[model samples]
Target chain A: MAELTDTAQQRATGLLRDYGAAVRAKRIRAAMYFVALVICVLAASWSGEVDLRKFVEGLPRFGSYFRDITPTLRPATLGSDIAEWYWNFPVWLELLLETLLVAYVGTLAGATLGFFLCFFTSANISGNRTVSFVVKRALEFCRTVPDIVFALLFVFAIGLGPVPGVLAIAIHTAGALGKQFAEVIENIDLKPVEGLRSTGANWVDQIQFAVLPQVTSNFASYVLLRFEINVRGATVMGFVGAGGIGKELLGSIRQFYYSDVSAILLMIIATVVVIDLLTERLRHRLLGTAKV
Target chain B: MKPRIAEPCDIDRLRTAYPSAFAPGYARRAAALAGISAVVGLFIFGVVWLGFSPSALVQGISKLGVILKLMFPPTAGQHMLVYLQALAQTLSIALLGTMLAALVAFPLSFLAARNVVGRWLLRFLTKRVFDAIRGIDTLVWALIFINVVGLGPFAGILAVAMSDVGAFGKLFSEAIETASPKPVEGVLSTGASKIQEVRFAIVPQVLPLLLSQVLYYFESNIRSATVIGIVGAGGIGLYLSNEIGQQSWDHVSFIILMILITVAIIDAVSGRLRRSIIGAQARS
Candidate 1:
């Protein structure tokens, strides 16, 4: 009877100890999260000029603004040359085509450049450390500057047209795709290249026969993906006066022509959907997963 | 039979094995591959066609040098306060927009994932919706929102949110599809409903990935907020563009510096947080 009582006492202590440890852990986690939340709130308030009073005062304005937006779907003014506005359809279509053309050329150029640069950029393949460092930094600098800034600068330098937009997109794509391509190259199996090297093949010959074949499918898929992104980018180049559908969209917004804006948006959405579908199909085919 | 003298047959075999060393086709293939070097020629042609003369560059460099001479030590005059205010606005816009997008995209991701939805048509349509939204750049989305909501940070917020919705949906769905199926199967076998299974199993598996992606997008959205500000969506970008337009190169340099510093800080913090989250998930 005495031993049985002792065993029960030990069991009770162990259970309590386990419960205490769990509670302590839970408290620590909760405190850490609470501290983090406080920091976030403080940082946001400090950086965003957020003040309760100002926000409260602005609430009514928000309501009035919603009221102002009620007549958003205004019909075309009865006598106001709807025909002239309707003529914009052809122009919009042409602009859409131009956007596609720019994306195509840019993607092709960028992919070609990126493919070659991948060899030099890959740490395993590079001949010299200095060369790799310079190439990597150059790509970083190219990508760090947003594409819009590039478009703006190109517009200033090259004068207005789709040329600047294409060049801008190409430069950006080269930077982005070059990094991705280098990663793909680095991840490739080295056995094939080693086999070629053991056969007394030169470095260039080894890369050509072994490395290129292994990564071609992945490289193709990346290029297709970049092309899809570039299509969207090309459409927006018009905002900087580099040229595309964005110009018309900007015009509609400036004039407050809601219907026309809607039409242009519809066109853009449709174009994007079609391109996306095509890319999906192409990617599957290139990856040899067509049956799947 | 082997005792008969073998005169350098190994070398002879090696030479015979790769006869392409002497073949013209080997050189032709090399040339074709190396043809990419011709891009330099195209670059030169573009320079000439675009009238980018070396002299013009040199002249512009001198002009830029003169401008740099004035932008000394970054003036913290009366406009400093205004600059800080605008910077804060930009950060808030990015934060609010990212939060909104994350909230919406987190649940939608499960519906969009092929493995979760278990229907090709639903998956395809859901993915297409994401694609359509993402296919329009943030700047264009800003323009659309500006028309709908009028000009302000509110418009910028909406624009960023809309653009991110597509991106987040895609990223989240990919994460869901990649999650381990074991826990999900176990939960389902316990007579749990589909929703319960997903809630108890898949959510835990994907939560860390979703958080990391959301954090990354937030870092990115900060940069994007600046861009949309150029279109009068009310952020530091508006000030930056105005400075550029006014040819205040000094102010432009200062603003660019601010952007760089802010982005760097956010990236470092988010990177640490992401790693910790991932580490915890791995441990669990």
Candidate 2:
């Protein structure tokens, strides 16, 4: 009995020691992480000139800017106040329409290009490994460079117009959508594809008969999502003189037309909300029907 | 919408039972045709309205080619130091901005999460607020901040932080909502208070996922920081815009190359960090 108790006590002590070592190691790691985080924060704040005092001082100005942008209204002249707030309603509407059209055209063109490119990029269908690898990298380059930067480049090359805006959005959209489409294609069940191949169907026929049916609805949904993003992008394309409501917004901002700035922002926000709702509904409908 | 069972050797019965399968209805066919026509019509109309002609495209491509040629020999000109410093500043902006946003968002996300916040109206309001703020792009925020706080990287930081607050809030709340209830129950069984339960249970469960998300956002915000600089909020983007204006294609290419490299490096590093965090969590 004495020998057995000694062995049990020794085992208990060993287990406790191991536990203590594990916990101490964990604490050290945590401490190191904390130190590293503090260092990064201090260095970043210093380099970025993140002065809390300056921000606090400017806080009032930020508040007042918001205040100034809010359109004043009284019960007596509400209609006139509203009308005056949106004084350039017609021109703004025209520009807004152009922005929508730019998004539409950009999305369509991008989706079409992405549709073709995705097949070549997808690992399952890519006939040539080198081509797939190159296409993937190109898509990454396109998406990594912000659409606005692309607009800046296009605006430089093509001159100021909606065309540059369209091209910029299209290129970015293709990159973004192509990756998504390729992923969808890669995830597809390959049994049908194999069956088609075994039946002596050519590559094109296999894709058409087996792959397209599985991925069309998904592709459409992705295209709609891209369109929503591109609309927001197109709104800002005008800042670079690529043509859109953004040009007007930028002008008002630079000239300090506070009311006009607020008015245009509201219109843009409303348009985005509406488009979001509409596209969401369309996507649901498409996916739901596809399932049925 | 139920599938119809057709009697074998009864073609007439099958046709009557599933008429739409044999021949689409007039209304359906017309609607389909109209949809196709509308799409084609809009494409043509957009082509004309946007002046997207083949001739113009060919001309623009040649101009782009010329610009590309100018960009081939990438050089930083005389302002290499300035460009490098600006690059560092961009990274700082993204890092600081993301940290600040995550700090601000941590508490707010609990208020937005359904499992944490019992009140439906509060959750709804919080979500809508997030949506509204997120709807405004980071550059727009940068422009506004420049007006309010004056030009420089400070504005860029504030703008990035402000925009990311919305995104982080939404994402963090979703992460919180998905945390398992078992942990909360276990914590409660120990007679822990509400705050204690959350601190000891929910947070631990969700922290790894949230950190991974924050890391991902940090990587993307670096990209955004570069763009926001073009609006004069401060960073290498300011350098880029200046060079572009001066028609210094080589310098512009160099700055762009720097951005791409920085972004790629950060992406790889952050991805590793996120994987490690997730792996540690799984092991635990």
Candidate 3:
């Protein structure tokens, strides 16, 4: 009994020593990371030209910029003041509509393309390994180049219009959605697929009957999410002179038309918020009833 | 379980009794058809409204091919050093912006979390604020910052930081809310203050997740930081746009390649880091 107690104490001491060493090692690792973080922060500040004095001085200007963007309104002429502030309302509205259309068309086209590509890309569906590998890399290239950069290229290629905007958004969307759709396809129950195969169903038929039903709702949800992102992307497409209210917004900002800038900004924010809410509802509805 | 049909007569009776289930009701089929038609109709309308023509697409593709041909034999020309500097600045902007955003978001996220903030109204308002900030594009923020602070990478950093704050706040708050409550209760049972309880329990649980998210954003922000310069916010983008303006295809391709390589490298590194950190937390 005495020997047993002695061994127990020895083991306890050994365990505590090991724990202490581990704790010390963890502390050292944490300290090193902290030091690295500090170094990076300082280096970033230096390279980014983050001057404290400039920032402090700019603070008041920042407040003023916001203040300046706010239209002066009295209780008496609030309605007219609002109207006057949004003087280019008709033009901006038309552009906003165009932007929405661009996003819509882009999403539809992209989702359609992704729908086809995902079958080819999905590991369980695609039998051709080389084809899948090549297509996967192609999709990566499409998405890796940011949509705006694509817009810039398209604008150069196709001449400036909403068409380039649509194409850019579509390509990026296809790349992004294809990857997601492939993931969804990869995760579907394979039993249905196996059963279809046993019945001598062709590859295309199997995909259509077994795979499409399982992934459609998920694909729709993802497409809607892409639409939301594309809308935001479309807003900035005009920055590259592709088309939309962004060009107007940029022009106003550059020419220092503060109120117009604010007006357009407000319209954009409102549109995004409304779209976000609508899509959130749609996504919930789709996902909530997905079991069906 | 239903009673097994032992005869053809019973099958006939079941089919008559559950005709709608056996063949989906007309209304349900009609609804599905209508939904598909509506989607198709919308696509057609959008195509027409956007003036999307197959011929135009073909023309554009050919034009793009010509331009892509010009992009071959990618070269930096005389501006390699300048381009390198700009790239570094973009990296700096992304890093600093992510750090600042993380700092601002870390505490504010607590106020937005349902479990941390008792008041529903406050939490709702906080979330809305995050949404509003996030709704605005990063470029718009860059434009605003440029106007206020004048043009430079500073504006780019501010823009990235501003946009990321909203994103980080939302994600961090969600992370905090999802944290297991057992640790919180254990800490509370020790008669610890609320702050102490949070410090000892919640932070440790969510920190790994939050850090991983922050790292992921940092990787993407590098890409954004590259673009903000097109609007005079400062970075490689200004040079890129300038090169494009001059139709310097070789330089354009070189710069694009650089951006791609940088993005790929960051993605890999951040992915490894996130996995390691999360893995460590899981083990602990």
DockQ (CA atoms), all models? 0.24, 0.61, 0.75
Docking class of 1: acceptable
Error of 1 at B104 (Å): 1.9
Off by over 4 Å in 2: A1-23, A290-292, B1-34, B189-191
Give the per-residue lDDT of model 3 (tens digit) for B150-172.
99999999999999999999999
In order of appearance, the predictions have TM-scores of 0.76, 0.91, 0.94
For model 3, what is the error of residue B240's alpha carbon versus the real structure, in angstroms, after optimal superposition? 1.7
Best by DockQ: 3
The CAPRI classification for model 2 reads as: medium
lDDT leader: 3
Best by TM-score: 3
Q: Per-residue alpha-carbon lDDT of model 1 for B128-164, expressed as tens digits?
A: 8898788778997787666656677777877898899
Q: Once model 3 is optimally superposed onto the true structure by TM-score, how far is the C-alpha of residue A267 displaced, in angstroms?
A: 1.3
lDDT of each: 0.78, 0.91, 0.92
Q: How would the docking of model 3 be graded?
A: medium
Worst 10 residues of 3 chain A by lDDT: A137-146
Q: Write the per-residue lDDT of candidate 2 for residues B140-258, one digit (tens) a residue.
A: 88899999889999999999999899999999999999999999999999999989988998999999999999999999999899988888998888888888888899998998899
- What candidate 3 gets wrong by more than 4 Å, as runs, is A1-19, B1-18, B53-55
Cα lDDT of model 1 overall? 0.78
